[model samples]
Target: MGHRVLAVLLLVAGFVVLAPGTACACSCSDLKPADQMRLSAAVFTGTVVAARQVEGDPAGPTPPIVYTFRPDQVYKGEPVTEVRVASNAESPACGYRFSTGGRYLVFASAEKTGMLQPDPGVPLHTGLCMGNRQVALGTGPVRAGDPVLNGDPISAELVDALGAPKPPSAAPSAPATAPPTAAPASPAASTGGSAPTWIIVAGAVAGAAVVVAAWRLPARRRVRRD
Candidate 1:
């Protein structure tokens, strides 16, 4: 009985020591790409413009890392021109890292702050569990400084799942296809337009010729009869 009790206590102590380490790392069953996209709040392709180290609690270890990205495209969520994201510099805090000048296809969460708040109105962030990572180079041929050279379009039925495909840009590109709209034609100016001076003089000359011709025609007809 004494031996059994000692063994049980030792097991408990061992678990206690190991628990902290397990808890510190980002833990999740590895998911397939489709599943990752399904679970993410937003997914996008961006180029890392900067990685700024941030200080956490003074009592804590080194600060986490914040990454700034210039987004070339958004695969999901409301379209935004650019974004900044934060993650742990180390795996222990579940932080992810971003390399300046590198491009990535990021799976991220949008955390909204009040409009009155300073900084980004809403910021994006991701973690190891979210599957934020680099796109395989073979994804596409990219030109220099292309923000989304990180990745090209992902073919998936799930594309429809990304909130109505950003509702197509409000501005219409091909005017031909747009629905015809009726605009009330402006009524011809109610005021009369002045006739040109040359037109008036020509009309007067035409009237005088008609009168003279009519008078001459009568006289010529009478002379012929006589």
Candidate 2:
């Protein structure tokens, strides 16, 4: 009887430790390298012309803020991406910093942006660095039009300190582009010269004024002679 009780106690303790581990495994899984590179390039360096915040879960849980990334250049690589990172939203501890119209470096392995969400119920926004690469915001607050990079000078030095990351197996290939169309010629091209239209008008006006003055002077001399 005593042996059986001791065995039961040991089994329960093992289950207790293993339960959290299993839950964490389901919750957090790090992203792959290729997906990380593609998303980082799209959001960080890409020019955003427009954006708006999306509200979430008023009666449910936490409200979500969503910002869109519009690409100036073509996204040459991946079809999709996803990531979860800390943000500048209001929390119980540090309060709110970023409201809307802000640019952030999102890190994720999968190619689905909408799937990305903040870690539930954690104060103090934690930055998401995908595939060992972290976001570096500029000095002062992170705002729209701020430059973001995977590894900057300071982060590059840190990478050197920590040893270099292993390079990805293969680089993403750029999409094929069609040949550029030539511009049509305009009819105005044939008349191009240095002299402007306003100069010609000014000269004609000056010539007319000089002729009038010469005619008036001759008439005045004739009247004086008479």
Top TM-score prediction, candidate number: 1
Minimum summed lDDT over a 10-residue window in model 1 is located at 112-121
Root-mean-square deviation of every model: 12.8, 18.3
| Total clashing pairs for each candidate | 1, 6
RMSD of 1: 12.8
Q: Output the number of the lDDT-best candidate.
A: 1
lDDT of 2 by residue, 97-179 (tens): 23233433333222222221333332212222332222333312223333344343223322223222222124467988988
Q: What is the lDDT of residue 25 in candidate 2?
A: 11
lDDT of 1 at 214: 96
The 0-to-1 C-alpha lDDT of every candidate, in the order given, reads 0.55, 0.34
TM-score each candidate: 0.47, 0.27
Once model 1 is optimally superposed onto the true structure by TM-score, how far is the C-alpha of residue 206 displaced, in angstroms?
23
